[model samples]
Target: MNKEILRLPLYTLIAGFILGIINLITIRILIRGTNEWTLEMGKTVFYIELILSIIAFVFIGILLRQKYNRTDFFKSATLLVIYSAVVFILEQIMQYWGFYSMINSYLYLPVSIFTVITSLVARISNLEHIKWLHVIPSIFAPYLFLLFSKNPSENTAK
Candidate 1:
């Protein structure tokens, strides 16, 4: 579905925002408390993050699948690489700056491989990996996080 000018990076922004807020809020929680989720909880979060990251890539594929048909392998390769770099940088920032905990180590251990898989699978899944599949995780993770987080009371950061 080649649509005119439905920018994939826009989806990236949306996905980044999802991941960014997760970084912010989770970091805030860690800063307030221990920043260490239980192994069970951490695994849960990792799975969730993996899901989100994958969705992000898959969505990018879906969104720009049409435009992608025209795009070349080098362009696709560049975009995949860019996605990896962005994931890494965000993970680093989330680890140190926002969350700022050894909990970062926990998040990182699982996610590095997760991100790699996200890159590979999404790239293959997409006729044009730059559009729909690439960006969907960004859109999904936030809402899912909100849905699942155990709020004794809703902490609306409004």
Candidate 2:
């Protein structure tokens, strides 16, 4: 049995969980106030942090591909799902602890999706003949851009 199969996905899962932890901690500190002024600031900080995370995923995913020679698309997607699930579970647990609210928590789902898609694309790009397949991931880049472009409502930004 090839070790790369287990290694890549496991590493991705761990990295995803770590990043999610960082995200929660950063947001907690940045969003200190409950009023409108602080709310707006939180929204900006959230988007900025999300973008930075996405960028980090892109680079890390690409590096993983180079190191492990990952080519299976399903494996890549599954790895991302693992990461997303870990973050979601952590967020839910935190909410239950009264550290964060449940309102608009689903918004974090996109971060996981976009990060995986971006990383998958980066990996697929390395293939020799499937030149067009590499472009599919770029489509999701607009979604990432749109995330930053929209004005998050106070109610949904939580």
Candidate 3:
């Protein structure tokens, strides 16, 4: 396999992860109080991030279609899923170590959407037999975080 096939997706994953952390920080900074307007602003920022992530995923999906075949698509998807899992594990460790806080459950929704969109695009464009088994990880990545992360109410009670 061409090294670019592996490198491109890894680079995109790292960039997306950094941008997600930045987005989380920005949202935290923007919502200074419990006011309605600040909450609305935070939601707006979240939606914007979600849209931008979808756009990036779509572009990458098309690029993969143009440059690679079904096998390559599988390789890329596997790499993405593995990298996402590693990142999630690291985030959990950071939270445990008190170096990071658990993100809102809503924040992970975009990641699940991105993964699904990428897989669908690859399946449709490459005409590949994408097994449901292969897609399970993509579907559950966000929900895994949601399940494991501390609830906001639980946090406040402490």
Q: Write the per-residue lDDT of candidate 3 for residues 1-158, one digit (tens) a residue.
A: 67755744654565467557766777776766744456567557756666766565555565554455555555555665665665556656776788875562323333444554445544556656654355455644322222223345655565
Can you tell me which runs of candidate 2 are displaced by over 4 Å? 33-39, 78-158
Candidate 1 off by > 4 Å: 1-6, 23-36, 70-76, 79-158
TM-score-better candidate, 1 vs 2: 2
Per-residue lDDT of model 2, residues 38-141, tens digit only: 65665565566557666665555555544432234234445445555565567568768889765334534434424445445544466534343443453333
> How close is each model in CA RMSD to the real structure?
15.8, 16.5, 16.9
Model 1 C-alpha RMSD to native = 15.8
Better of 1 and 2 by lDDT: 2
**Weakest 10 consecutive residues of candidate 2 by summed lDDT:** 142-151
Q: What are the Cα lDDT values of the candidates?
A: 0.47, 0.49, 0.54
lDDT over C-alpha atoms for residue 17 of model 1: 59
Q: Clash number for model 1?
A: 24
Candidate 3 residue-wise lDDT at 78: 63
